[model samples]
Target chain A: MSNLPNVPFLKFIYKPKNELEKGGRTEIPAPRQSSEPERRCPNCYKSVPLSKISANMSMCGCGYHFRMTARQRISLICDTFEELWPGVVSNDPLGFPGYVKKLDTVKVASGELEAVVCGKAEIDSQPCCVFIMESYFMMGSMGSAVGEKITRLFEYATMNRLPVVGFTVSGGARMQEGLLSLMQMAKTSGAVRRHSEAGLFYLTVLTDPTMGGVTASFAMEGDIIIAEPGAMVGFAGPRVIEQTTGKTLPKGFQLAESLLEHGFVDAIIPRPEQKEKIGKLLMMNKAVN
Target chain B: MANPKYKSAYEIVKTARSGQRPTGIDMINGCFTDFIELHGDRYFSDDRAIIGGLALLYDIPVTVIAIEKGHTLKERTEHGFGAPQPEGYRKALRLMRQAEKFKRPIICFVDTSGAYCGIDAEERGQGSAIAANLYEMIGLKVPIISVFIGEGGSGGALALAVADKVWMLENAVYSVISPEGCASIIWKDIKKAETAAEYLKMTAYDALELGVADEIISENGLGGDEFYTMLKDKLKAAADELTAFDGLADARYKRFRKFGSYDEITIETEEHK
Candidate 1:
């Protein structure tokens, strides 16, 4: 302890990567870049080649599903996609400290203007409105732009009498936007309800780490809700729950398997089989125009 | 208790969470007569955190739902300190749907720190329950009004608050996250909560300015008969006005849809290129 106190620079050098508060910045290391040939799997710890992982829908050989970008997920599921409202961008409404800088950084890193990508697409010849949340963009936080895009998409779907498919992977509402981000929960849910009332099918595919406000809103408002294998889907994050309850959580407490056991999620579909499963459901529930 | 004419946002937050404040049961008993309390969500056990039932709002029938934080410690424990579980929300929804069946207006009293963060709540689909309310409430044909009598905490409060009109007491606070939680997360210190409260825009006046709430009820003679009587008059007036309007669902939809604030960027992208 005396030697550690003497080494002043050691504290800075030994800081943990996941610790966001110690560092003034909230920037996480960008997910596997294209330049990197192989990336270490968080689950299996095997360094898998990028091309092999991409070919396997970003899943490691050990069955750990890597988080895919919005575009990447779109390409996998949508046979034909026409992007909608690509020009919408977020503003620092609250003028929150460092918000614009954080947005810029994430925009460059994620190569997306916002966390969610909404578009009209076809899944196995069935037409639908689709939205894929970008996990790389601020951990898929629902800011104003994200909320507006999804709400607009749902409105469009309702008007067109089209089925809607949403893939949610969010940490929660973007706190930088303050209460506006929280209001998105009600906004998106209102749109979803309108779409549902129009007699259109809405299916939500909850990806890993779908928690907080998003979970408490449109992500859980689907007519049929499914989840990716081992996805964490809950209103409160496990850590927050543990802190509040002051009790140790069991293993895989909020995982998709656990949700399925508790009758929350309809099914836990693996990434590779998702397209077929979703396509079949879409095909079955085709709205009679 | 000192009733300051000018309370800071943090002070209002503190006051909203005070134990002496009128709970849901107290409000229900005060505002309405012949209240018949409804129990259970049918799918699960009745949650004590939420008190919902049918009541006569002056002469008109209305469904009343509120998140009750009990006055006594034993009562608080029974009510889970006003933090609702999934079943509590489900029970509220059940009463709401019943109100819709009878073409009755709905009035909700919101007071909660947030949803219950427990293993059982998660297992029972707390997220889904709140989401369901938001979805269903928007499309409900009847007029709905939510009054924030105390702390309107996050999604738990929002579950019962997707109303045509939202009101907040002068001392009440509605926030995305608690000031203390925000401080601890952002500053790594809980002592910065006062500053966090200022930035959060959680006060009733702030809520009105931000368009999150329509009106701010005064706290004059708070918890007294006159306070409840004035609130009842306002509730009746608002509900009557809302009931007269057509296309309520669409209005409610627009109310929430217009909440987002963002800028448009016409930069050359892959699509344009």
Candidate 2:
């Protein structure tokens, strides 16, 4: 427990021990274990040991970039992340079926209050506000809580006049919240506009499967938009599009490389070098300002 | 009576979707003069679904952006059934920004079934493009007047309609989702689209009642000279009112910020009760 990052603080907030037996929800599922030490690379189709992949920061030999959790991404990109608004929790406004239960389950499963975790951090000694959406948490769906947190983060960045670096990964708006979820698109976009109006720099790092309402709003409003290699960035998912149009899509459609070619994304940066590249950009922006 | 109340949602829907109805092109041609059409998003191919350009609205230099539903079958196919692609939204934003730079008022005609739902559209970031338009438009210093001339469906319409003043024609309908889509999602039957349309409350009159739209212009059955005259008058009045405001950007931002409603309920404990 002591070895776990921010575990003590999270335990204090959740009161897991006391609430677990009373509600029968205290059990945290253990991490999955593999039968073998090696796993096949989806891109290269080559057997690679999990240890080697972890050592390489989850990059395959054939340039396939494995998705990372928000916590893992923050640790890799920032020297230290001081979390903001950690106590903020979702009110589950609509009381949609199983919504609160799902939130609790995801909270325990992902060790996050919501899909997004945002705060101030330093990349290569350059300070900036970092918000990372964890795909494991409800597929990084944007609900009222997630939207509010992001808006507040942008407000904080604006007030402090700091650069903002956001790593976005989502399936889109949370359908459980109904129109409240959809409204987040406007709310977050409004926040981004205010941030931009202040002349602060914003960089969006699009990760695997950034789609739906998330793609429409703040994700596309960045001054410089970057994406991970092979990351799927788009509005509607390919399956929906295929079903709607009844046409087979071209190979590598909606991939980051394709977006870059279309001039939608500024560049595709690998996970390992992302910190250095972003830090350099920040420094350049700082000099100009 | 030039302003006849619609009998049913189905009737209004049918009229709005009819081929004989005046489109964005017709409105531009009828209401504005010396119109010069702009092209391309500069990042991708030009989307013909959204037609925009600089034009003179009664001698006032204004930027005109409209969602064009082509009249001919080939033109409709080319325009993606009046649904905008990512480039279409991007092109709108590009033109809107240009309007801002030149201190020109913007007049947009909302007449889309919805945003395009194609593989290439999604791949290029359709949602992002639309959202970008919404964001940028709110901060634009120039006055913006958006009129829903036909079917204003979903977020696709909202992308262009986030203006200082939002108006709708008598027969137009603006809703979060299409009637068929709502019916299929809720009742699992596309046949219930008429019922769903009623439930959605998307008519221009309903929009005005809900405060979602500022006003609804009365279009007589003639659909020619009278309709154009009313539309032009409304556009001039809206543009004039917006131009007189000192803080257009702030007003625009505040207008969108105050959009929905919610209620708070408190629970009492047994002891308190």
Candidate 3:
């Protein structure tokens, strides 16, 4: 440990093909066992995976492509001229039960004001209210603050006569605030009513583990519910439901594909296609916009 | 302590008049003269979440079917988390259809957010039960009066709330979803439920204005003890008055029809439409 050389420098010197020339003779060091490559694909062996074979397909050597994150989502839809609006946040109130303490701890660990990021942005420059929820914060649990922010945002859209796009990801109610936490569902639902009353457009996108309060309220209340492929969107989760029923759920029970076939979501939007479709919706609503 | 009881009906309306809110079963038991707790839907099983029975409110014989949002973990489990599975709603349906057969007035205390959304519920067809309730309850021959005491969520609450007159306690809430759920969707954070609360406009007052709830039950100097007592009395009085309504049954159907429509202007109007 005491004589360990710099890793980058040793990496260059230890190149097996580049042997050192010392005293008129070339000396090659034995290959390090640590240099062995990691897991290989059982299928057609390839090193660089995740490279797309076509526009809509991800060609992975292992035949596995990961689900997209919320950040990757927004950027994909709104590139170049995509200007994300300033975000809204939540603060604590109703020092009920263990809520105040939980919020304090979550803020430092999750580094976001609220789980959702809301602002004015465009799908191809369409003036719309965009809200994207981050699942990292307290499992994107919704409380009064989150509820009120969304209500105000909805109300703002209502007042402005703008369309709204919401992406949801959550575990369930905060549960810490008790009745106060339960109150948010009504609050946001009311805002949605006002928004709909104003003849404004609103779309809800459900994502992985989108259960509990989110599913109960406006997440499922949209005119057009959209979901990413394989996303789970329901009130109680599948596992909990399975445990309660004691029957094995059909494959992709609450998955986006299932929801689509069942007529819950209008489409299973690919990550790449999300922007274009939203832009198209914005365009359709543009006459009102 | 009857010797030292507070004087006047107003005094009885205190929060600690009883120290806690009355359970769905308890509320009916205390007010009614002959309380008979019935069980089960012949189709499947009984649901304790909704206690269906025969009772007399203010000397009037009636059938009561209530959506019980249970208290405590054990009660919650027993009540299926206060979310009526298909069986519970079906049980209520059986009772409702029976009430219709007897031409008895139906009294429903709604305190559930919605039908159980658990997997067992879905597999057993919770949505179908809820939809069936909405459909059948609307045309029941008997007069129906619904009281929103705690929560009235989605189809679960609606199963009971499809009544001639829907009344809400000053603090009760009724909505398609709860605020925490909305916040989770809109903010991606459940802790921001306070914000969700502010946004949903879910207060009884809001429902009253929106035509969702017909009237709000004024506490009238009430606290925990007498809250339910005063509420039950007021509810009893209200239900009695509704029977005098020439078109009470029609009113019930109209109330539910309001939730069906969605109104939104085309985006073309955003600029100049």
C-alpha lDDT of all candidate models, in order = 0.89, 0.80, 0.63
Candidates, ranked, DockQ: 1, 2, 3
Backbone clash pairs for candidate 1 read none
Every candidate's DockQ is 0.46, 0.29, 0.08
Q: Between prediction 1 and prediction 2, which has the larger TM-score?
A: 1
Ranking by TM-score: 1, 2, 3
Q: Every prediction's TM-score for the first chain?
A: 0.85, 0.85, 0.73
Candidate 3 docking band: incorrect
Distance from true location, Cα of B177 in model 3, Å: 14
| Clash pairs (backbone) in predicted model 2 | A216-B127, A216-B128
Which residue segments of model 1 deviate by more than 4 Å? A1-38, B1-5, B271-273
After superposition on all CA atoms, what RMSD does each candidate show versus the true structure?
11.7, 11.1, 12.0
Better-scoring candidate (lDDT), 1 or 2? 1
lDDT of 3 by residue, A1-289 (tens): 1222457677555534322323122243437434644434334555442334322333244443334444555665554322232233444433334445666677677655567666666677787887777787788877655665676688788877888889888876555433344445545665676577577888887777677666656686676778876677765667656665677888767777777776567888866567788888777765343
Off by over 4 Å in 3: A1-70, A79-102, A286-289, B1-65, B68-82, B86-108, B111-120, B123-232, B236-273
CA lDDT, candidate 1, residue B240: 93
How far does residue A82 in candidate 1 sit from its true spot (Å)? 1.4
TM-score of chain B of each: 0.96, 0.93, 0.81
Number of the top lDDT candidate: 1
